[model samples]
Structures are given as C-alpha cells and as structure tokens.
Target: MASKLIHAIYKDDDLVLQAVKQIRDARYHIGEVYTPFPVHGIDKAMGLAPTRLAICSFLYGITGLTVAVLMMNFMMIQDWPQDIGGKPSFHFYQNMPTFVPIMFELTVFFAAHLMVITFYMRSKLWPFRKAENPDPRTTDDHFLIEVDASDHNVDKLTDFLYNTGAAEIKLIEN
Candidate 1:
C-alpha cells in the first residue's frame, strides 16, 4: 500500500512550531519539517537527541595536535638538529615554544575541516546530491511539516492542520 503524507505549509516559524507541538501532543507522527532557515529549539520539539559533533571535533583536534607534535619532533630533533643563533634543537621539549604556533594552527585546522566533512556526511549532503525540499517556497520564505497520514483520516488531518494555522495543505502518496 502506498504511504500518504500530509504537507502542512505555514507562513511563519512560530505557527509551524506551535503546530508541531500540537500534532505531537495529539499523537500524530511528524515525518519531517522544512524551514527557510534554522529554527531554534526545533530539535527538542522533534524529540531528537543532541548531536555528538562536538566530540568528533575534539578528537580531530587532538589528532592534529599529536600529528603536529610528532612531525615537529621528527623534523627538528631527530631528523636534523640545528644550532641557529646558538639555540639548540636537540630536544622537542626544549624547542616546544617554537612549535606552539604550529600546534595551535593545526588543531584548529583539523577541527574545522573535519567538522565540515563530518557534517556533510552525516547529513547525506555528498557532492552532486539532489535537493530534497518538497516545495521551493520552503527554501525561501515558507515552512513545511510532513505529517504521516497512512493510517489516519485524511479529511480530519487536513482540518486539524488548517486549524493549526497551516497556510496550505497537500496530500501526497509515496
């Protein structure tokens, strides 16, 4: 059997948020929501867990720091010990001050770059991926809530959405 979805379109963010809360309260499943931009507190309203991207960023930063330390140690101390201005480079600890800048830069670089890649991969936004927005207006000035209507009364759901301030409602089968 084809699954039916109700697209409840709203003109304002507050209306969409309120509708989402009411629908969830009424025990109707919300498939997804599309907004012109980020909507604050939407994740909590959608009952989504907090993301772990920060932990990934920290690990990436630590990896970069370790790489920087090892590379500097190998190059300056083990590979070629130089004596410029009588400043000995015999030990990494002794030349640690000079490597501080590189360490900091590498840590930030790794954290930032890896976080971007992680975000893209997690969001399934790989290169050349097709857009998934149900309506072009959602990318401009509209908000959309996709409610699951497979086992529900479509007329009642449509009426409920209209009562919840949906500017437009579309019934789609998938």
Candidate 2:
C-alpha cells in the first residue's frame, strides 16, 4: 500500500519550531523532520524521548580508565620493573601519581571516540551511506517537517501547513 506524506518546508528554524508545535497540537502524526543544523528543543517539541548517550559515554570512560590502570600496572610493575626519576615500580599505588595523567587522557579519548562512533551508527550515517533527506534544500537552508497524510485530508493538511508559515509544501507518496 502506498503511504501519502506532506513535506512542509520552512525557511527559518523558529518558524519550523512553531509549525511543529501547531501540528502536534492539531493531533497530526509527524513522520520526521530534517534540518541543516541542530534545533534546540526540537525533540521535546516532537514528543521524542530523551537520549541515553551520556550513560554510554560514562561506561566507555570507565572501561578506558580500567584498561589504562591494568596496562600500566602490568607494564610497570608486573611485566618488567623500572626505576625512573628515583620512583620505585614495586607497587602500583606507590607510583599511581605518575600514571594519573595517562589514565585521565585515555578515559577522555575513549569516551569521545566511542561516543562519536555510537552516534554515527545509531543515526545510520556510516561512510558511503546514501542520503535519506526528501529535499536537497533541507541540507542547505531549509527545515522540513514530514507529516503523515495517509488517512488525513490532503487539502486540509496543506491549508494547515500553509497557515503555519510553511514556505513550500510538497506531497510525497511511498
């Protein structure tokens, strides 16, 4: 079955935000929204759930810290003991101060890299991936609101979108 959708393009981000609020208030099902840059509070306006990426970042940082500690312990104390700067490598705790900088750096490195990779994978934006935006202008200067129109009146939706300050409206079927 073919599903009908209405693409509402707004020139300004503020207008798009207002249109989204109006559309949701009118009980219309919004399929998606595309924007060139981040629109603050858009997720809340769209009634989307909060993200859990911060939790993942924390876990990744902990893992990196653990790995750094173990690696330093094994290399400095267990594998081959070293005496540098008159500091004994007999105990990890005794020489822990010197490894603090390495541990902190590794923790930040792992969290940042893993968070970026996770964001890319979650958004399905891997290298060589085809673009899924319905309008090319959305990547430049337009913000698009995709409304589900399968069971709604097309003319009414068009009127509502037009009234809500849409610069352009396009009907798409899939």
Candidate 3:
C-alpha cells in the first residue's frame, strides 16, 4: 500500500519552524523534515523528546575507563611487575598517577568513537545507503516538512500548508 505525504517546502528555516509548530498545533502528523542545515528549535516545535545519546556516551566512557584499569592492572601488576623509579608495580594504587593520562585518553577515545558509531547506527546512515529526502532542493537551501496526508483531507491540508508559508507544496505517494 502506498502512503500519501504532503511535502511543504519553505525557503527559510524560520518559515519551516513556524509551519511545523502550526501544523502540529492543528493536530497534523508530520512524517519527517529535511533541511539543508540543522534548524534551531525545530525538534521542540515538532514536539520531539530529548535524545539519550549523552547517557550512552557516559556509559561508554565508564566502560573504557574500566577496560583501561583492568588492562593496566593485568599488564603492569600481574603480567610483568617491574620496579621502575623506585615505584612498586605490584600495587596499582602506588603507581596510579602514572596511568592517569592513559586512562583519560582511553576513556575519551572510547566515548567519542562509540558515540559516533551509536549515532550512525541509530540514524541508519549506513555506507552506500540511498537518501530519503523527497525533494533534492532540501539538500541545498530549502526546508521540507513531510506531513502525513493519508488520513486527512488533502485539499484542506494543502491549503493549510500554503497559508503557513510553504513556498511549494507537493503531494507524494510512497
């Protein structure tokens, strides 16, 4: 079955933001939004919840920190206990300051790399994947809001979008 969508095109981010708020206020379901750049406050206007990526990053950092401590403990304490600079390698606490830089580096490395991977996986932006933008102009200078028109009167929705400052309106079936 083909789903119908109304693509409302706006020339400016502000115009699209305003249209999104108005459309949501009118109780219309928005399928998606495509824009040349990130629009400020569009997520709030579209009534989206806050993302939990930060929490994931924090957890990843903690995991990295744990891994670093374990690796250092195994290598320096259990594997090869070397007494360098009169510091005992058997006790991890005695030489903890020397491993601080490595621990910090590993924590940041894991958090940043894993966060990026998580973001890509969550967004489904795999390599060689096709784009989902209905209008190519959205990749340039336009902002497009896809309003679900399957359950609504298309004529009324189109009129409402036009009045909400859409420069171009398109009815698409997908």
On TM-score, the leading prediction is 2
Writing each residue's lDDT as its tens digit, candidate 3 over 1-174 gives 679998889999888888998999999999899999999899999989999999999999999999999999999999999988898886899889999999999999999999999999999999999987788998999999999999989999999999999999989988
**Model 2, range 34-109, lDDT digits (tens) per residue?**
9999999899999999999999999999999999999999999999998998998889999999999999999999
Candidate with better lDDT, 2 vs 3: 2
In candidate 1, how many Å is residue 54 off?
A: 0.8
Model 3 C-alpha lDDT versus the unseen true structure: 0.93
Ranking by TM-score: 2, 1, 3
Candidate 1 wrongly placed segments (more than 4 Å):
none
Clashes of each: 0, 0, 0
Which residue pairs come into collision in candidate 2? none
Model 2's lDDT to the true fold? Answer: 0.96
Deviation (Å) of 163 in candidate 2: 0.7
Assess candidate 1 and give its TM-score to the true structure.
Answer: 0.96
Model 1, residue pairs in steric clash: none
Summarize candidate 1's per-residue lDDT along 1-174 as a digit string, tens digits.
Answer: 999999999999988889989999889999999999999988888888999999999999999999999998998899988997788997899889888999999999999999999999999999998999899999999999999999999999999999999999999998
Sort the predicted structures by lDDT, highest score first. 2, 1, 3
Error of 1 at 95 (Å): 1.3
Candidate 2 segments exceeding 4 Å error: none
The TM-scores of all predictions, comma-separated, are: 0.96, 0.97, 0.94
